[model samples]
Target: MLGRLNHVAIAVPDLEAASVIYRDTLGANLTQPQALPEHGVTVVFIDVGYTKIELLEPLGADSPIAAFLAKNPSGGMHHVCYEVPDIHAARDRLKKQGARILGDGEPKIGAHGKPVIFLHPKDFGGTLIELEQE
Candidate 1:
């Protein structure tokens, strides 16, 4: 079962501006921006109760976030991350139930050193899902 609502990923076109919206407009605390060269994105986190919101802005063409935004221009929620004790067990459970995984292998490092994976929205009632073992 899920441990906690870890973070929600939002795909934004501008990381700084989006960070401001959450921090200034919404009054959420934000962390300094960080770049993940592997994923080609710059991200910031805003806490909301036990779960934090992750703002992701693509820094390159290969970024999956950019591709998501291209497909859904008015960029919205990218994924809902649920903290788990065992990501592999969660992955196996989802796969057996016919869930579509975006990546082929094990979980990869997501923002903040958390191991994460995406479950295709098509398989999750139109909501992209992320399982994080943090």
Candidate 2:
């Protein structure tokens, strides 16, 4: 039920520094930083062809990115997002197959203003998976 690779998310300790590398160094097109308080992150999207790279920085001490940074110290790939034609259907199918969905198992509005849900990393080869409705 997954469609295409949507975007790869990277949790960075320093958002501005990361933006510089992607923008100035790599010559990537990046969006302005946007604070997503609901998700507890400040994000910027680096456009690369059809797909994009999402840079995430912790918005507060309780942010999940903060915990991720605490373990990695520097920062690392946080998750990979895939598009889905119908998010609810995808969730039900995954659930039936015994895949664990993170959080409350409900779709939340994502950065692209689309419904999204995160699946448990352990179920997807130690890589967090995000499903976004297209």
Candidate 3:
């Protein structure tokens, strides 16, 4: 089962520009940009007290974020991540409940170095849901 809200991810065409908006303009605390080649994204985390905001930019042409940007030139919220006590158990439960898990239905190391999985957007009211093990 899902736990607390982990972070909300926003796809951005330019990571540095977005970071400037959050860090300089908004005066938010932000983490250094980290390239996640495995996930095909360059990301930065903005500290927002209780939760965090993730800014993602495509790392490669094949990156999923690139496709997302192609559709909506102006980037937007990509997904909402929720924490889970046990990712494996959560995956099984969601599977039994007919929730479609994205990718190969396996957990991958997320930006926080925690196991995470993405669920189909259609199953969650058109919002991509990411479940991360706490």
lDDT of each: 0.83, 0.92, 0.92
- lDDT score, candidate 3: 0.92
What is the per-residue lDDT of model 1 for residues 64-107, given as tens digits with 9 covering 90 to 100? Answer: 78778888776688889898898888888888988788878588
1 or 3: which has the higher TM-score? 3
lDDT per residue as tens, model 2, 42-96: 9999888677899999997689788789998788999999999999999999999
Clashing pairs in 3: none
Which is the winner by TM-score between candidate 1 and candidate 2? 2
lDDT of 2: 0.92
The superposed Cα distance between candidate 3 and the true structure at residue 80, in angstroms, equals 0.5
TM agreement with the true structure for every prediction = 0.89, 0.96, 0.96
After superposing candidate 3 on the true structure, give the runs of residues whose Cα lies further than 4 Å from its correct spot. Answer: none
lDDT per residue for candidate 3 within 1-134, as digits (tens), equals 66999899999999989988998899999999999999999999999977789999999768978888999888999999999999999999999999999999999998889999999999999999999999
